[model samples]
Target: MGPRNMAQGSSQKPEFFVNPEFITTKTRAIADRKRENTPVPRFTALVPRGHTVPVLNKNTLVESPDGSYRDGPSTHGTDRFERRRADIVAAAIPVLNDQGFKGMRLTAVAELIGLRATGVTYYFPRKEELAVACIESGFAVLDGLVAEAEREPDAGARITQLIALFTARDAAVRQGEAVPLASFSAIRSLEGEHRDRAVEGYKAMFRRVRALLESPELAAMDQTDRTIRAIILLEQLFWAASWLCDFDIEDYPRLAARMADIVLNGVAPGAIADPIPSLTAPARPLASRDESKESFLKAATRQINEHGYRGASVDRISASLNLTKGAFYHHNEAKDDLVAACFRRSFTIMRETQIEARALAAPEACRLAATVEALIRFQLGPEGPLLRTSVLSSMPVEHKTEILGHSYRISRQFASMVVDAITDGSARAVDPMVAGAMVHAAINIAADARPLAMAQAPDIVARFVRPIFAGFLAA
Candidate 1:
């Protein structure tokens, strides 16, 4: 009447088996019971693999978005059953495409796939697995890009190649903002460290941009810190190009140039007389193939920076010379390739401008001030807003975060310029790094300062973009 025992020789009932007859007296009931317990699959232990986020697990998973296991009995799971979940993904992909990570819902996917919620649940007993698949697909897309970038000649060329590999206009057209949009969505869905990882990867994109900008002719800084400064400047430009949404997308080139100047040249020292002019692009005679290439790059920069990546089509690039896609491809491989080329050319112009500005500064303070003016010019200029929308919005969050790392260096460069000015009787001597960081921070705050005042926005944005920078440098 108490604890039931099941031994070969004894007559007892196995626990959970209501019928004592099932506990055969002819077998070793203890050994059987122990074996059964050994194989008892713990339902509570069925943590889904793709259970990355509630967003991915609950929303994106089609088959078993809510499926969780139970260790109680063999009431489910078919070894032969592959759990296709195609119906889930088929319907899910469109929603995911449109709304990104947030749109994936198992019930919705089930409704679209013509499966009952339970029917869908039967295959996936857990929503996590389905999310894992979705995540896998995302990674597959990323891997494809990494593989394509391998064909690049050097780090500089590799960035162009890598960017082209993923950010091509054709890719955007084919997928309707495929990689960029999806990644942007995924980043929004991911939480915490996972989000951070995405951010770091995106920043690497800028790292490549910096490498291209810091090429032989433009790179005058032999010091590691200066090189780091250049990298930071490129990062800021890369981010401003990729994600600044409040403004027109075309200004990316101007933005890049000014940012480059700030990092490479530092601020100019002269007193304030007038707002710097939004100078017209100089006329250049592109004659030889080399010149033609340069011109193409320059023109391409102007176009993409003005129009977002999607807006700037292959035809647009070729149309400048009445050329076709074939002709464009003859010069560049793909639209993304062209983007990389455009970025490089933009950096080239910016570098040249920065070098000139550095030379023109009458005092060291003037030089430092020049650096600040150059940065502001691009953002306030016509090209700034356009480039902000077009090129910058296309990059993923991971890429944007990486760009910020480079921007840190630019802040130091600004400070260094101030130091130089003060040393040579140009301006007062002070903490160069701190002063530069303040100005650089102001520029960054303004870069994405729309829809809300960076000075008085939501907590995260406000805390992140505190605009006390100008005051920091005020003499």
Candidate 2:
């Protein structure tokens, strides 16, 4: 369910992992360019040898849609089709890594087999279906790694084995051989049964890690903190794919060993983590303080976006606006109320965005595209901080449920637009629910800005919607 999934591969693939110096240089280049308001420079990561790259070649001996060998006579299309399906999913893993779920194009997969987009759909029917298959496969691979790691007799050895699993995946990413699940955010793009299944898949993975952490050895730690520690370790492992690009691929084993040591024993033996610092608001002009609620909400939104809900202190929110804690109490009963209020304000803006999209006097397809574009622009703009929905998971269950209801309503509206487009022949026949979820997902992708590079807002939005409307292979 993570936006990206892994492929089943041995942990012995040798490749030159991206060195830290390369990443630092790229980061500095991007920062300097952003400071000058210049477009960010884009570069392609090297794809690992043997990982198929999509290229159109008619002479290539590729499997046909019905599982026939296009170059010669073959068996009936039953088992071959399933194998082909697996191949398509494998091909897509790299695309998902490069472009994400929203930015991924089915055509890329088709090109891997020298087929058209329609040919790919003959099997998947809908893009979401393909995504599910890839995600399931990826998670299954991860599950296997966890199961393997569990077999190790020593707890530290077990942890090292698990770290090695991810380290291998990280190298694959550097060489573009696989996708890292850490960057996977497309889980929120699923709806109804798909969403339920995906969420459960995520929970299962989390539970596996939690179980590993809860192994009798760490019994002295608080259960809640143990869970947090498990989450933190997993997060660090997930993101290691990104950071590992800067280190020699050969160092992965050493890196995994060191990581295992750090996780099992603090960097400083017997040391405890320090408290997270709070965000303080900068000096605001007198005009801003008059609307205390608005000012506080803005400050809180920024803080929460950066540090998460639990980290965003109510005390800090009040201080950011140069107001006392009493000023916060006067405007809101508690931090929960403030968070709820923030969710309301964020979703309201989102709903208004859809409303504005619908109000436009244009074809349904155009309207849908416009609405998505508007939402993306809004998410990346100053209001972007408010759109961080990660905080909702930390909210009281009732509050989370209420806010989710509002979120789903908006998603359904997007789905409705997709249904309209398909009905009018502006889009191919796709599951409206999945299409809607994808649109929602794409907006979030824009917020993340992973695949967007230096494109203008309009261009970025257009590219984001292209695969959704025109199929990935559309010319």
Candidate 3:
């Protein structure tokens, strides 16, 4: 997106609008292009064309002079290759973090760095090939941090570094879908070698943490259990970065401290400190007590978002706000009505934003980009968590249908963007409806990513989103 930057040109690309009602077709076409091969996006950004050849990447192994890698060598790269790989990643991660890998194309990567797509292919031939390059680059960076820990003899410092990496991502979760939007697709539908590597990577991560946490005093603790616990906390952080997008550790200081305490001090019921005392207070109706309806709804919304509608009892919501049932019911007919209100509020905002993006842009790409960009911002931004909560999880059939209808309208509105991209034959593999659905899938992934996890990366978001649109954007 940076460097020479063709993708983020001042000029617009294209646009289409989907209906907010029923899905008219089981399959829809967005764009169709001739099966002619085009130059792939090379890692070279903003430099003029040259007679360069594609070299060492995913399938090819980079070997050192001595045959074996350095003292703490990672699986990929020699010293020269490592530097080049880092350069490629440095130039490209923003694609994932900003547009999402799905949305980002190697062409855009080349344009950002001022080269032709063929030049990009010179670095790595296939899209998946570059994808692997990008992934290896990310891991290499982590490897450096781990290597630093190895340099330190003290166990505490090593453990701290491991924990630090858990919370650290490419950037602070700035945009709502910023962090998780890109990676979510892979996480959701892991397959092939990438899937296997991902699983192994996580396991390796835990093993490192366990290794660091070991000490004479901690000898009695089970490293396997400790690693498991760390993974759970890491998952929570992923939620925070992906959903909340920007909360610092302090917002939930206790969460981090509690985890550390648990990890350091065993949870042998005897060894653990007593949890904060639970209230023994009896529930009362809102009418019998005094509390504002605004307060009641606010409390309910938070509960529903966090604990879920089914898991969050009406009594709990009312009790949380210190209100009685009658007072709570004074403003609404039933919980269904309240949920409907929530859904309506969210749907209206989504609908208006789409219409606004369309209104602000022009015919072809700009119009489409405006709409897609707006959707991207919303899915990753403040509306992210609320969007997830708006879906009627564990609700009754009628309620679930109503909430889904609300979601459908929002989704249908997005279909129009795909239509615009397809009309121009702007991107590769551009099927307007399929692209639209893929966008939905991308958003769903973002919704599931927690803040602390790797998903809270703006670069990763760009990688995913941009590639997706790259597939949709007409040449």
lDDT scores in order: 0.38, 0.52, 0.40
Cα lDDT over the full model 2: 0.52
TM-scores for every candidate against the unseen true structure: 0.33, 0.45, 0.36
Lowest summed lDDT across 10 adjacent residues in model 1 is found at 50-59
lDDT of 3 by residue, 294-328 (tens): 35545665555544454456676778867778766
Which regions of candidate 3 deviate over 4 angstroms? Answer: 1-86, 150-155, 161-190, 232-475
TM-score winner: 2
Q: Is candidate 1 or candidate 3 better by lDDT?
A: 3
Question: Which of the numbered candidates is closest to the native, going by highest lDDT?
Answer: 2
Write candidate 1's Cα lDDT for 357-438 as tens digits: 5676366555444544454444333334112322433444544444334444454566666677668866443445444654
Model 2 over residues 320-428: C-alpha lDDT tens digits?
Answer: 7888888888888888788887777777666766666666565566766666556655555554544465455446676888987886787688779867766766555
For candidate 3, the TM-score is 0.36
**What order do you get sorting by lDDT, best first?**
2, 3, 1
Off by over 4 Å in 1: 1-270, 273-291, 319-323, 371-412, 422-475
